[model samples]
Target: MSTRAITGDQWVVLRVPISGEGVTAEVAAFAARRQLRYDLGDDGTLRITDPESARVIVTVRWKTLPPQVPRTLGFQLPSAAAVDVLIDPGPGLAAGRIAAALHDALSGRALAYTDGELEGIRAAMPLLERYSAARPAFDNWALIFRDHYLEHSTGFVLAMERAGIPAEWIFALDKGDRTWNRERVHATFQARGYRSDVLDNTAVNLPHAHGDELARVGADIDAFLDAAHTAGRRVLVVDDGGLLARGYGAIGAPRTADAALELTVSGIKRIAAAGPLAIPVLNLARSQVKSRLGYREIADSCMRRLQALLPDRKLIGRQVLLLGYGTLGSRLAAQLRGLGCRVVVVDSDLPALIDAAESGFTTYRTAGQALAATSPFIVVGTTGERALSDADLDLLPDGLVLAPFATRDFCALTENAVHRGGASDIPGVGMRFALDRGRRVTLLGNGRSMNLFEADSIPNEGYDAYRAGTFIAAASLCADPGRVPAGLHTAPADDAIAEAGLWSAYYDLYAAQGKGAVRPPTVPAPRLADLPAPVPF
Candidate 1:
């Protein structure tokens, strides 16, 4: 084989000899089989060039190959004949080695391979290896963002661009409204010379088409993914929860999973179970403590809205039923108590109920007992799951208020009742849903997230922490995947500390710009005192 280096380029030109009889015909046949383009010289020399820089060559004499050259490429060639397969390491030596190792292992390598060799191969596939080697991780990365308004999404793209990574945005407009400033997002992408696409929530339910209306939208998503794959770009899906996951799963799981990296706020549990590296950037317990403040924001917002809508009904001295004593529930409970409301906590999870009990609050294993006893003036559901069933709705007192702090599903029963003329709002109270037969119940934000719907958005200070933590997590993942195990991993401790510093800097920056700044409250570290004492089931 003859080799020569090209100046200022990582690529090199190499010639591998095919010495057997009918060498030209054999090489031509192999190239044709591999769908490789080639040309035959007048001297009968067969030459093949890769459209991209990568090329692979294989021959029977593996031992004769250069020591610096990788052996994994040789394993891919047909063993039946002596053939020279030339491969160009377009992504540089490190990526080439990693890709070759993965391909080699996936293509049925010998079982005799030692653990040390496997570890060495895995270590080569770190997220930043390609970037560090002067090769792009992919031609471009597709960023599937749940909220375009969130600074995190925009900031992430900006950071990646600064690092010399080409990225595009795919925004999920869940409500299909122009309120999200579509024009502004488009203008930003255009000014930055990046491509972007918008998809609505309907795409989540695939194969069940909504006639011609949503067909084009579905086609858009498909075309976007196809273009990314064709261009050899990787996809990084940053979603709030199940929307993108379900959409991707609906389209085709294997192919989508192969090309995308999913970072979710709420769906990491499900995604991690499927054997992919699902980074939890937004989980309440794992990533950042900012969500605790978000919960407080939602609670405070809901209380203020309630007061404005019904000035006669005060939250102080009211009996409140709180469901799901998780991160949101616990924080909201504390806030409600501080506001002079007596909070009764209920959760199906025994440990959660016990924790609430241990926290010096009244606890109930079921909503029935709490409802019957309290006849609560206000009911707040913080569990991500459906907290109120039809039966639970029937048990509610005539004049009561319902608020879902976690997700919109908590208000499903109220929504259904309202549609059926079983619920209606009091005349003077805004967002107060009253039931038929003179029964009145106020449903806050119609069961949607109070923080988003009532509070307008997450507090800027909390959002800063969330975004900073996410930035550090993404960068850390890229720099070293070996440090992160293949499962749902907590945000790095360093990221949490960095998040605080980042938030402080952000506050100072805001102040310097003459904008009033609100520094996030220092969240006390979680204490084990809230843990439930062991009680044999």
Candidate 2:
């Protein structure tokens, strides 16, 4: 059925095939929830009018009679009056693809929706491609992402190559176990029809590397940057923190060379004074941490999985001492509380402590007091700083578990303890550090980021947001490096919105395929009395 050109305004019609009875209701519900006005026809036609300035009309038409009919979604462009998009709702269509198509049809315009409405559309549709008529230029640019055996970084590299961007990868291999291999990573990239040049630096992986080894790695990065500069290629470095930040400093001040860095918090602080244009992908924008597909999801999922590893230590109905009430800490607290664990949050920041208290969690100004009071079954550090002082360790109860949500720095205080014959290997629990001779405290992942060390890989939904941030960073740098200042920057508003939509769509698709659950945990709200009273200053 053809949609008649309604008089007075142009329309962008989206015609989708209806295979069953519920399709129309689903579409109507989606439109209503989005606050989009629609006109329904008895002949199985629905017209959706965009309230924005574009005046685009989306039409959904049934190709077959009544139920079990195939449907088509078509979009009519207002800018290009003659252009129209007709997409067949093929068998096994994914919600993400549909959303991508719609977003693409709207010319990448942001759509305002109520909370959960985006997820609703994502669940209803699942997968669609955002069709771009013109691929952006990246001829003079090259991308370098830190490969950590996750699909997101590799996926981003593949995507950049697909967009005609020259891309390479860098892998900080675990020298002890060779956790990441250059040959394996290259082979994986080769399978996708791309040649990979990975800077496999073992020194970067060694958190405790010192002396000549660290200096050698620094020189290696300096040379790499110099080569890219001499070649006149704009280098976009992802995962520009930790060891990589040290390398950036070794290269001296940022020259007039074409080099841009996308960094985490630590990286930004290290290189900010050097005057290199940096996009702070990890924390600058609240969206990066607060979004549905954020680190919290990964942290929560990983923490819950710890139950199987340490079956004897029951996570449910146990007290958890959380050090540092940052994004990761707060999210993990809520998830643990959902599983019936009493969560006590400790943070030096008064505001963070207050926030935790307000969120119905017991808050403490010092780790020692929290540990002594709670006698927690598990202690998690999320502050990215040394969470446990030597004094605090002395206060920890025997048989307690210590897990770091951040990198190893958060647990640095335990290093000396481990070296002084304080840690002993537990049968199934790995190393258990003894603080006061007899008090055995199990250290998870040797005080590394438990989520990264324990989880096989970050969930694809969370990684999708990471990939989006990387893409935006690279694209922004490529578009005009000079336009981006030397200071830190957040993902552009439009890119953030587009990425959020993509993230929801991908999450819904993953759920439809039984990959994993992307929905946030549903927990009973905590009562104020259930938590300890806030410590007075």
Instruction: Write candidate 1's Cα lDDT for 385-481 as tens digits.
Output: 6787766666788868776655534545543645436544443332554445666566755455544442234433334444544544444444444
> On a 0 to 100 scale, what is the lDDT of residue 289 in model 1?
38
Scored by Cα lDDT, where does model 2 land?
0.50
TM-score of each: 0.56, 0.61
- Top-scoring candidate (TM-score): 2
lDDT of 2 by residue, 472-523 (tens): 4455456666665544556553354454364454455345554464443112
Best by lDDT: 2
For every candidate, C-alpha RMSD to the true structure in Å: 22.7, 20.0
Candidate 1 error regions (>4 Å): 1-139, 148-218, 247-254, 257-265, 269-285, 289-312, 408-437, 480-486, 491-537
Give the range where candidate 2 is weakest over 10 consecutive residues by summed lDDT: 70-79
